[model samples]
Target: MWVLTSQFSRNLTSHSSLLSYLPDVKVGKTTDTGKFWDPHFDIHFCYKPNMKWSVLFVLGVLSWGNTLATMVPKEATFYQLDCPKEGTLQYFMLKRSGQAMMVDNTYKVMEQNITIHSNGSIIFHSLKVEFEGTHLCVMNHPDNSIHGHEVKLRVRPLPPTDLWGAVYESMFVTGLIAALVIAFIFALGCFVYKKQWRPRPEDEKPVMSGYENPAMNPSDDGESGSTNM
Candidate 1:
């Protein structure tokens, strides 16, 4: 078992936003092929309005092994992640407080190779993730202790396979090109409409329907009639 913990302070001159400071903690464990040494972690966190003694004690109890702690109004949760490779296991977590409370849309981007084994395994490298939601935990949370939702743990490293590039190319770049093509088609249609709409001798302009006005109507007076006669 390996564990790491940290703490920091943030200025609280005004409550313009949910004032919060957090200690990031990391934990790791390994297991054998037997029944239960499987790699997993169970963590607990307590949130206080300020650095209060009671709050720290509460946080400590939850971390130690008190199952009852799980019943507390928890804003952060512990999760178990799989470690396929014995190398560096990079991990991250997000905890929401004050303004974020829910998850809506979440996305993850990986720039390099990622491989998956037949056993439902996953690997990723150079990964970027974006999540949006009401009461989202990472950037926007809505609770006083933490915003709303929380990422208790995240472990990252290079993608495990080589197929990652193809996946991203299909989803992002290909989609963008498709959208542009559609817009171009619409522009062409507008141009055709303008070209066909200009006043034409066929459809829009008035027609000279009454015998071309005779070019010069014969006077009703007898003078013209007599000359022609």
Candidate 2:
């Protein structure tokens, strides 16, 4: 029987905001026809906390097995396991002694914060600071099929809230100042335009009285008035 083991690590620092980490581990086994076996799996984790923190562990199966067609086809069966906690999975608190403990349906050391999903996958959650050290996952089959994987978890400290808050407040104040400056400039431009505005000139009309008409000469009117006098 050939044994396969694969190891991988997923960093939770990438998701610091959410304070959640999900490790992706895949395990599978194949058997010939007329072979019956039960598979067993276990996960091991170690955590030391600088301060008080909480964590959760969840377990589920992704795919059971696939059938192979041949002269004698092998049958594949899928099984689902329940989560460690009965109802809502609670977080396991890690104390100052650098020890992590969880209270749940299962009394196992690392099984406390576990939750089993419909699909078989294990999820571990805790504060970034509280997660440290090496984690191991073991899968065993009755037919001597054993697979193992190693995961190293590392978490970085979150940025100080006061610093981030100050940055946000500064940015908001800067934006407000910029908006006020823009509005003032706009109002000044409108005021200047109104002050500099001038009215357009209208067309002039010619005087057209009986004597002032162009057809009646001013000298003829003067001679007639002199002759009448």
Candidate 3:
């Protein structure tokens, strides 16, 4: 009878040990994979196919949108817009105000000069304080597809006494002085050439006396005496 009691106690302890090793199973919910869900936590963990690719696609779109924005310099003489040259494209520049105006590439719009370069870059010349606003660069492809790039231009007035202003003034003065010096030197050289090449009258020939004239035949006297002897 003691052996039977000890055997029962050993069997009970082995069963308890086995149960402790097993995971705690809840009766709240079961997933499609036959896994039991915890009741306390409301989180649902599932594998989404192509999740990495979806995240990468979202980030690529964000980066592509950022690439379409441009910033113009505040104190620049010109602003350049580099467009993609993948297809036959027509370029258009638009000024955005209360109403959008198509920027003309003519002298009629002298203040806002536009130039299309050999490359696919559009140049906006003579940036002015009035041009401080939003601008759009539109490219129309052969397939009727349109792509737009936006620009925010702000042109600040250059100070009269700034370092760059001083430098420009000094350069202008130096250039003016150099030009004047070159002009003066060229004029002096032209004057000297004219004077040196001027036509002058020839000097008059000196008249010789009869004694100084070899053609008078002074040796004829000695020849006549020898003949007389």
Candidate 4:
């Protein structure tokens, strides 16, 4: 059970191949392109090596049908495999479930061999069990006719999410949210502690107006004073 994934550029005008060897067993197989193939991203799975059972599935599509054939690039051609040296192939299986599926399936693949044959085909061991999915299978000598080149395989599964996206919903608000909250609180406190119209004796005293009071006239003041004496 071995699964291998690869990626390439769409603009090269000619198809290309690569060969790399991975000695580590973690995070799955990774093949970096010695050559850069830009503007094109492709994904496929290789299921079951050397066995009659092999299949390739195109990813990121909603449904599989005739309509998909039309979507495939006319300029793009199928990729072949290549190996550096001759060696016995080793394999492993990995099971993965995604947002598109109800459960995960075990995928089988091998780490890069110290020595593998040129133009070899590889496959995922368990992909056949999952008829509802798409994957890639390796070729016996995909690159023999093509010659020495570097190929990159992208096989690691990404994190999945439910209805809500990964980072779209934010509890964090900036600028206006903080400003409005502070303003509302300040206004509310101001109203509660506001000053009233209550006045002291000085506050009640009247300033000069146009009319004069007859009680305080000079003649009236004199008459009052004479009577008092």
Query: Which has the higher lDDT value, candidate number 1 or candidate number 3?
Result: 3
lDDT by residue (tens digit), candidate 4, 46-123:
444544333334432434665665443221122223323333222211222222111123222233112222234432
**Model 4 residue 131 lDDT?**
25
Which ranges of candidate 1 are over 4 A from the true structure? 1-53, 61-155, 158-186, 191-216, 219-229
RMSD of each: 28.0, 29.1, 26.7, 26.5
Q: Highest lDDT, which number?
A: 3
List, residue by residue over 1-229, the lDDT tens digit for candidate 3: 1111122234544587644733453446868864444555432334446667889999999887766533435444767655567443344454633332333333224456666553456566766666666565566666788777665656666556588889988999999999999999999999998888544456545667867656445465565322232
Off by over 4 Å in 3: 1-76, 84-89, 97-112, 117-119, 161-229
Task: Tell me the tens digit of each residue's lDDT in model 2 across 1-229.
Answer: 3222213253334555423322343223434532222243222232334232222211112122221122121112111222232223222322223332332322223432333232223334222343444543333334555443343444445556699898999999999999999999999999999899575455445546776655344465465333333
Evaluate residue 171 in candidate 4 and report its C-alpha lDDT on the 0 to 100 scale: 29
lDDT of each: 0.38, 0.39, 0.57, 0.36
How close to the true structure is residue 202 of candidate 3, measured as C-alpha lDDT? 65
2 or 4, which is superior by lDDT? 2
Q: TM-score for each prediction? A: 0.20, 0.21, 0.29, 0.19
After superposition, which runs of candidate 4 have C-alpha atoms over 4 Å from their true positions? 1-172, 193-197, 200-227
Model 4 scores what on Cα lDDT? 0.36
